[model samples]
Structure formats: C-alpha cells, structure tokens
Target: VLPHDPSMRPVWMMRIGLFLYDHLARREVLPASATVDLRHGEIGQPLKPRYSKGFAYSDGWVDDARLVVLNAVDARERGAEVLTRWRCADAQRAASGWQVTLQGPGGQERSVQAKVLVNAAGPWAAQFLREHAHIQDSKTLRLVKGSHIVVRKLFDHQTAYVLQSPDRRIIFVIPYEGEFTLIGTTDVEHNGPVGQARIAADEIAYLCEQASRYMRQTVTPADVVWSYSGVRPLLEDEAANPAAVTRDYQLELDTRAAPLLTVWGGKMTTFRKLAEEAADMLAAPLGGSRGAWTQDAFLPGGDLSGWIGTAQRPDGDFQRFEQALTLRHPELSEPMARRWARAYGSRVELLLRDGLGEVVAPGLYEAELRYLHEHEWARTADDVLWRR
Candidate 1:
C-alpha cells in the first residue's frame, strides 16, 4: 500500500526512474500484481492515497545474514587470507609495504606485510585512520542511531506500510519473521560506541506512536517482542537534519607513500557495486587486477536460481528443486528436502550423501554440524547458529 501526502508528490519521478533502472539492470523491483487496491481489507485506505505497481512480498531474508559467511568462504577459496577473531593492533608505513600486526583471541600477536592497506571498518573507520594509519585531514563521519522494534503482527496480509509521521519522517512497518511486524526507525545523533547502540525509551515510544497512527491497532512498548539499534557512520554532511544526510558512499585513495584506501559510508544493498568501484580505482597502482568478474558470481548456496528445466519459468524453481530432491532421497521428508536445498543449494546431494539423521535439535542436525565444521570452519555453537 502506498501512502501519499502533499509533500511527497515529487517522489513519483523517483519511483519512475527507479522502476526504469530496475528494468535496465535485469532486476525485478516490482511484482506483476500491476496494482494494489485499497478497497480490500488487506490494505488500509490512507488519508491521501497514492498508488504503486507491486503488491507482493519477496522472501529476501535467506540470502541476507548468511552472505558474510559466503563472502569469507569465497575469499578463502580464491587464496585470500582470512583471519577471524583477530584484531588489528598496529599499522606502520614500510619501505616496500605496510607493516601490520594482528592480535588473536589468545593474546598472541602476529605481524604481516601488505602492499596496500584498506580500511573497511564501519563505525570506527575515522578513528582507525587517525590512530593507526595516521592519515590527516580525513573525511568526517556523522554517527546517527537508527532503531527498530518488532511487535506482534500488525496486519494479516502481505501489504506493508510506509508511514509518514507528523514531523515528516518516514517509518516502515513490514512483516517480519512470520509472526512479527517490524517497525522503525529513528534518526538521532549518536555519541555512544558502535556496539553500544541501544533502543532508548524515547526511541521506542516514538516508533510505537508513529506506527500506531496508521495501523489498525495501537502499538505500545508492551507489544514489542524484540528491538535493536545501530549507529550508522554516515558521511558528514552539514545538514541540520540527521535524516537528510545522504547515504551515497565515497572511495578515497591515499598514495603519498604506500597505498591506503578508505571506504566511507556505503549501504549493504550496493556493497558489491561499491567494491567494484573501489577495485577499479585501485587497479592502476596495484599493477591491475583480473577485470571485474564478480557481477554474476553466486553466493555459496544461491545457485538454486540457476537450476535447469525452469530457465523460462524460474519462478517455482525452489519448489521444483525441493520436489526433485525428495524424489532422489526418499528418506528426507518434504520439509527436510526443502530445508536441505535452501541451506546447501547444489551441494545438497553431497551434504546428504552421509545419510540423514535423527534430530540433534529442533532445526539443527548432527550431519549439518559435521558439515559446518568440516566445510564452514564452525567450531562453536554460536558460530554455527549465529553466523549462518
């Protein structure tokens, strides 16, 4: 459902441009629903209503949190050194390269040499630049706190709300995790540490008050099942409004001596594009790289989209794959087959070759634990459960 007011009429141009770009980029940004009807109780009638093209909910969560694992594994397979649970302790300019020391969890330290240094540190990028790299005149970062709360399901339909508060700020009320309605967010200046961002009493109240304006029922702090907050290190724009700060990123390369590159504010949605741009800038001085080839590379278990027999009709590929997998292995239930395909993709057969098991936990499997340790380097329960 699209919510419109007099102030947001200009967004039609942006929506058109976005749809056009999505088409040109071969990405499906809108569903084929063609229109959303407010007459249906699935969607609420807004005070000043506007219309949009899509009325579908895409299951985009499976590929999100696991992406970090996929990236680390892919990098390791490509001969890139990956050190986990290690902290960068020192960085010094050297004659041939930069001298760096990493402190491991055991309090042991190791030093390495690298021709170039990259600061992809999210919230601590500026501090790391000054303290470690000693870079001067660095770009400033405005740390803004964004918070979200998940309450009992607000609506029964797939339709979500893009609500505009009286103060003209926008908050989204999207269906989340099957049983919750996710509402957010607040834009407040943050001075706390990155990891210490917390949902303040005022932030929670603000979210509840804003979302309750349009939802069928009023939401309160008592309805919140879960909540989280993060400090976004936005590129410092001297706008008095924190929400008005632009999210566009910047890539800065310092080559006065050894090469040092720092990536400023960037969004995870465009991270691969940002990385490609960063690589393009660093290619020349670093004796060039294998020209950009990551545009079509799939994550670890994302190859399910490429299964055959559904190239022309790839919409039901996941269901079809689950069916085929069930047929191949009669031992697996339909739900288990679907889970295997989703968690392992093309590696399902290999992962199941060792035989299915009696349950180890509710959704955890003994065989899966073996797979995680043998393949994904998961040593602890948190590593397997949290990172996956």
Candidate 2:
C-alpha cells in the first residue's frame, strides 16, 4: 500500500481553485510562476482544509479537458507511439513474455511481445483485461459516468462558482472559453463502451435543475450549447451510491503467470504519480534497473520560472506581452490572449515559435497543430480544436 499524507484533506477541488483565485485578485497580473517543495518519506503533516460557500474553483483555465490531452501529448513526446483506430485482439502470457495482438482498421492482424502490458485503458481496463488476459479473478473497475453542460454566461464575474448541490455533489459554474458558462456533473453508474459515452437527456435536465438552485439566471436544457460525458473508472467498492465510490487508485500486479499490471481509479491530477507506481511494480518482473522518476519533473509547457505576469520587468509588461501575441496572431482577440496565457502559461513559447510572423494557421497555429499531431497523437483536427 502507498503511504498516506495527512497534510492533505478531503477538500473539494473547487476550494483549491478558489484559493488560487483569491490569491490572484490582489495582484495586477498573475504571478509568472510558483513552486512546491516537499520532504521525502513524509506522509502526515497537518490537515487544514478550507470549508465555505460561494468560493470560485478553477485554475482560471478555459478548457479543462485539454489537460488530459496535454498529458497524452507528453506521453507521446516521451517516445510512446500512439496508434489510432487500432483495437486490441488478444493479450496473454507466453514463455518469453506477454504477447498482444492488434486488429487494424481492415481485417489485418499484427502481434507483438512485450515484457509488460499496462492497462491504462481508463473505464475499459477491466473489460480489456477480460478479453485479452485470461484472468477471471481480477479486480473490477466500476464505470461512473459524469456529465457536464455549457450554458450562456450568467455572471459578469470572471470567477467560477463551486456551489454545493443538495445531493452533496459539488457543481461548477465555470467561465468557459471566454464565451459560455460550463457547469455540470452527475455521477451515475455506467456499463458500456467508453467510446460511445455521451450526456443523456436526463443528465442535462438534472444539471440545469441543480445549477438553477444557485445562479441569478435560471438555467434550462435549451440554454446548453454543448454537453459532454466522461467515465470515471473507480475502484469497485461496496459504496451504495456511485458518487460514494473511492476516487483513490488501486494497482493489481499479475506476476502469477507473467508480469502484467492493471490500474484503476485515478484522477487527472494524480495520473503522473499513478504511472510512476505502475512502472515501479513492473520494474521487478521486467528486470529493469530504472527507479521512480516523474515526481519533480515538469509536464510539457509547464516550466515558467515566475508567476505568469509578475516578473519584475518593464512597466506594462502584461500589456506588452498581450499586444505582442495579438500582433503575431491576429486571429486571437484580447480575450483569447488572456485565455492562452492562463492555460499554456510559459508553454506559450511552444505555440508562438514563428517569431512574430503572420499566423500560419487560423484560430490556432500550424506549428501547434503539427506539435499536437506529432507529439500528442492527435489523429483529427477536432481533437485539436475541441480537446486541445
């Protein structure tokens, strides 16, 4: 079992965002950077969690789903080939190692052998294991569907709300992509193909009903311009409600036949940590000398040295940066600059590599499009526009 840190509390994610926003408001511009230092082998420190109402919760980020895509892109950057439209056929243990077969778009077949096979398939981990690995007695992965809705902006404040629902779910009325209000998420049990996930009519009605209880403007289904669904693969527990299921992760090591590691129940914030642990478990059977490594490493485009706009530089530095970006990419408005600064931060350098030249692509640039395709395994333009 992994060690627990008592310094952490059962604080909701909204509270974390509120804390950041509260800190941001006092300054003229966002800090260019901040860093966290920690002591190794330290678990319990002190538990001090914020509890209140009407607090805004967000990273001031416009597109939250892009965070997931960024990590996938990072993985590809680290030399993992991302194949598209290929489905797994059979995976089992052989004398040499685990062999996995893949079926491509057509009736073609390909097989490969690996020292370890990781089940990072999200909601389909268990199902994938059942079909590929002949492991009957395995940990079950409970698929819980969470849905969100996008509505017309209701509040003038840029801050997002983390309001409490009567059913104990925390709903976010976040300021979306500078144009709409994003709110959601109902945790309902699901058992189906993860690719076919979508927000249901009832889920839409439920979200609107819940948000209407707090906001000045009453929300209805018709106001929703967009909606989405993601399946949280929770570790199966005896919890009565799907919401009560633990978000904590569990790793099952199958060295009984060969070294196969299956992971379930992890958050976007904790995925790097999860990957490290899974890699460590496979180290023994894979005969690797490699040790855990991702803790202190920065994810792609996250290595700005100061708070975003707080560098002790020339006057109007924030304005200068925004104006420079706008001049370079005319497609981006002032609000888009604001959005890009917060989301990409120092990583904006990666997107603006043309040195103030005319924008090669519309809305976003061709360099970014190529980067997302080459490094992040983005197969389509929609993945770039929507997910990125």
Candidate 3:
C-alpha cells in the first residue's frame, strides 16, 4: 500500500516496511524517505503490511474477445451451435416457447426457437427488452463508466503501485504489455451509447495527475499511448455515488407468463459461479440440471495442475509441461515455448499444427493468424490484435 504522506508509514504499521524489488529481492526496513531514494523523486510512501508474507500480484491480461470466442468454441466442442454476426430483431411469444427472429449478415433472416429467454446483453439488456419484447420489461441497468490509460513504462520494477488520490479514489499503476504502464479506473455514471464509450479528457487528466504524484517521472496527456473506456452494466440500486454502487449481479426469473430470465449487473470475477447459478435456475423449469460440474471441469486449453507459487517467479508443473512440449516439438523456440505454455497450455499441438509456421510478427505466426481466422472468429487486423 502507498501512502501519500511519508509520516503514514509509522501510522499504518510500526514494524518497519519492506519494499519488494523482485522475486528474490525484498529490501528490509525504512530510512524515512525511501520512496524519494528508491524511486528517485517520487512523492509516495510504502509501509509494511500488518501481516507480512502472502503478498501476490498477477500479470494476467484477458483478451476480452478471445475469452468470448474461446468460450463459444468450447461450447461448440461440447455440441452447441454458435452463430455470430446475428442480431435479434424481435422475440414473439409462441405456443410452445419463443419465436426469435435473428437477422444475419448479408441480409438473411432466421428463426430460433427457445423454451426460455435469457437476456445477457450487458448494458443493452434493458434496451433490448424495450425494442424486442420477450417479457414484461421491468428491469433497469445502471451504466457505470470505467476508463484506463496505457502510457510509457513508469517504473522499472514489476511491483505495481496502488495510489490513493486526494479525491479518496484509488488508482492502480501496473506494468502493461511489457513496455507500458496501465493506470486506471474512474467510476462515473455513463449516459452515452455503450458502443461509444471512450475515455473523457478530464478522466485522462485525473489519471495522469494521480499517477504522476507517485511515479518518479511526470506523466501528461501526451504521454498516454492509448486509452479505453468500458461501461459496467450494474444493477440499478439508486446509489448516489457510482463507485459506491454494488458490483454484485442480480438474476430475475419471471416465470409468470413464461420462463423469462433477466441478467442484470454481474462482476467478471464471479461469472462462472453466476453462470452455474443461472443454469440451475433455468434448468429446473425446463426439465432438470446436471448440477454444478464446472467446479471440476477444465476450460479449453487450460488443464495444467499444480500448486501456484510467487507471482513474479511462479513455480508449478507448467515448467515441466513446457519441457514436455519442447521435447515433443523439438523445434519450438524458447519464447514460443513460453508463449505456448501460457496461451495454449496442453493444447499447443493444435496451434503449432505443422510448425509455429512462418513468423508474421514477433511472437506471432502466420499459422496462428490463419487458425485464429478459421477457428477463433478473427476477421480484421484489429480483431487479431485487440480481440484475439
């Protein structure tokens, strides 16, 4: 934890702090102005955690589109038809269930019949209800905006800083994309179209100013390499503060007329659990459920098992798995081997196909791009870079 005032060090924890430098390097004690000395002209202070040890950090970043694509792929592998680029024009009540009109790309319309209707359209769930009446529209969505800025690397160390601003909001300055620092997150009510969500100038300035107060180097708007904003679909709680709003999700099952399920406001962290609960709710009415099976199930491309180690230097069977991969392939490069260990896990053979096949870019291969296009639904350059 980074305290704004140097005197806060003694206030938070009296037992002198440890500034974690790396996996094997944790400098002990404090000489008062450690931030100024360690970070060189930074204006923040670090203190020892009340209960030391068990401090961890992850460098995991999910490609949002890839996550969706992979889930769909997994579903398809488990025998489910997935149709993308299809828009639900309307859903009319039918004798048995619902007659959903799906408009596909290149001017084609199809009908999909479902016994139960589930609205998981994120921020557009309520709007979808209004335009396409599947049930009595009573649910509301609280659109909260969250923005993040990627800038040139601020700190040399892997340990990220959680900065508390004067406004009482905390922002994170974490290493991003290897050569950049990712700083974020302002919670404000959003009114615009969710598709048009973008970082506001004030938000960028706020992030920059807040980060600059702690980082050794001063960061300005021009220093920002890229910025993005996402609208969080929160449940309408009538909360005065957007940040104060609940992140918990609410599932409404209206079985009066038919089985109409409305998914409102869910945190990504508990998505799997929420999904299992949702399945249980919908299943009992339809026929029956298999109960919660995902607890023991492994996601596609993720089957490796072992105890997790320190964040910086993770110790697991992953290393042995990679060694096995190298032994099997015999031609997979060091960096590609590591990438395979992370990205594909045990399913790397499906990716290597013939070989990592013709370098299209650093750490990216032509075969991978083709595979992404053929399987992962990557259509454009942005889809390949930003999505997949």
TM-score winner? 1
Instruction: Please give the RMSD to the true structure for each candidate, in Å.
Output: 3.7, 9.9, 6.8
Estimate the TM-score of every prediction.
0.85, 0.74, 0.82
Q: Model 3: per-residue lDDT, tens digit, 47-146?
A: 2222121223233345565567778888989998888778899988667887899998877999989998888888998988888964547667889999
Sort all candidates by lDDT, best to worst. Answer: 1, 3, 2
User: Candidates' lDDT values, in order?
Assistant: 0.75, 0.67, 0.73
Model 2: number of clashes? Answer: 8
What TM-score does model 1 achieve against the real structure? 0.85
Clashing pairs in 2: 31-307, 31-308, 32-306, 32-307, 32-308, 33-306, 33-307, 73-376
Count clashing residue pairs per candidate: 0, 8, 0
Q: Return the top candidate by lDDT.
A: 1
Q: Over the stretch 65-113, how does candidate 1's per-residue lDDT look in tens digits?
A: 5677778878887888888889888899989979999999899999999
Model 1: lDDT of residue 68? 73
